[model samples]
Target: MLGPVTTSDPLLTDRTPLPDGLDARLRDHLTFLIEVDKLKTVLRASPLAAADRRENDAEHSWHLALMVMVLAEYADEPIDVGHTIKLVVVHDLVEIYAGDTPIYDTEAGVTQVEREEAAAERLFGLLPADAGVALRALWDEFEARETPEARFAKAMDRLQPLLLNWMAQGGTWRTPGVTADDVRARKAVIGEASKALWDAGRHLIDEGERRGWARQV
Candidate 1:
């Protein structure tokens, strides 16, 4: 049982004093719980998966972090790669509550902003106030796609599945009845951050068409 916490509480450090107290750390823990649970549920939900499975949020975050490392050089604007990585990794923690909504699911439209906004408030608000605010900012930045860092992070998010789809020989594209043109239309957004990667992505999609792995939907 968590009992009353006094100045002598093990969680308290005498060397460091701050106005925020027990409530703050408890909030942080709640945030952690919400995010971790979200990670588990999002794992298998990839749009490119043949099985229509979702990737757990944690795995997806790691994947995006690695992409940030590899594609940082291709960004069109100035960006701190590490910060971009942080933005992508933690961006979807709220989706644990909101759930993964494939962009193509226009009929179901699971990706509504209201649901996500509510999820963000509940999930991110569970953290220490400062941390909650910071994480919420990162999540909002990724959603806004306005800042250089956010643009690059979103670009990576869009490109990764395309690459996976191509490499896996029409993993989700074939099953979802997605076409080369659709892929191009979707990924074109990456150009906002990195022209080089955008061109490369185009070339790859073109090649897939030539190879009969993709066609007009």
Candidate 2:
């Protein structure tokens, strides 16, 4: 009989050989799908010009990871910033499959959960077992919003749209009919996760209204 493999041997690691078909196929499909998302840029106004630049799904994940790096101190509670960042980074992998839906679009937002759930099942399922399970769990945590990590991650997601709209002089709000009050009501949940960011957002929304930048809800 062959001798038992050594526990500390690097070769003993759980990697499986890359096969030629389905075992390797879904990951490629996922990659291509996510790439499409990055190419699907948001349409903005004026100088914002939507950049004609689509931020790929990977870039979106990386951007949120960057936010977690820089804004973690502002979190309402102490957090494992690394873990928090990881959660945010992977939170949108599902967007690759479901496509990015703007929160302000009420009807689009309604189907988000279902779409994302389908996405989660498909995308995470692409990976080999262990990694797939781990990624799915992080994705699930964000969806459930039942943990501190999830709460902060979700807050970051909401905050991103607010920042984009504000930077573009109310890109989302500038739909010629989007009101300021609507922005507040839409973004109020920011407080539930991070009061600090919420307060800042309120100030921005208030000033946005005063400056006639964003319409009031």
lDDT of 1 by residue, 1-217 (tens): 1122122222222234444655768646644653465366564335434444545767777888999998798988989988899899888776666666665555435336766787777767656788879988889889998899999999988888777777676655564667888778878999999999999889888888888787665
Per-residue C-alpha lDDT of model 2 across residues 53-125, encoded as one tens digit per residue: 4345565566678887888888887878899898987787666556666656666767777777876776666
Model 1 lDDT on a 0 to 1 scale: 0.73
Best by lDDT: 1
lDDT measured at residue 98 in model 2 versus the true structure, 0 to 100: 65
Best by TM-score: 1
Once model 1 is optimally superposed onto the true structure by TM-score, how far is the C-alpha of residue 184 displaced, in angstroms? 0.9
TM values, all candidates:
0.79, 0.75
Error in Å for residue 51 of model 1: 12
Residue pairs that clash (backbone atoms under 3 angstroms), model 2: 38-55, 38-56, 179-215, 179-216, 180-215, 180-216, 180-217, 181-216, 181-217, 182-217
Query: In every candidate, how many clashes are there?
Result: 14, 10
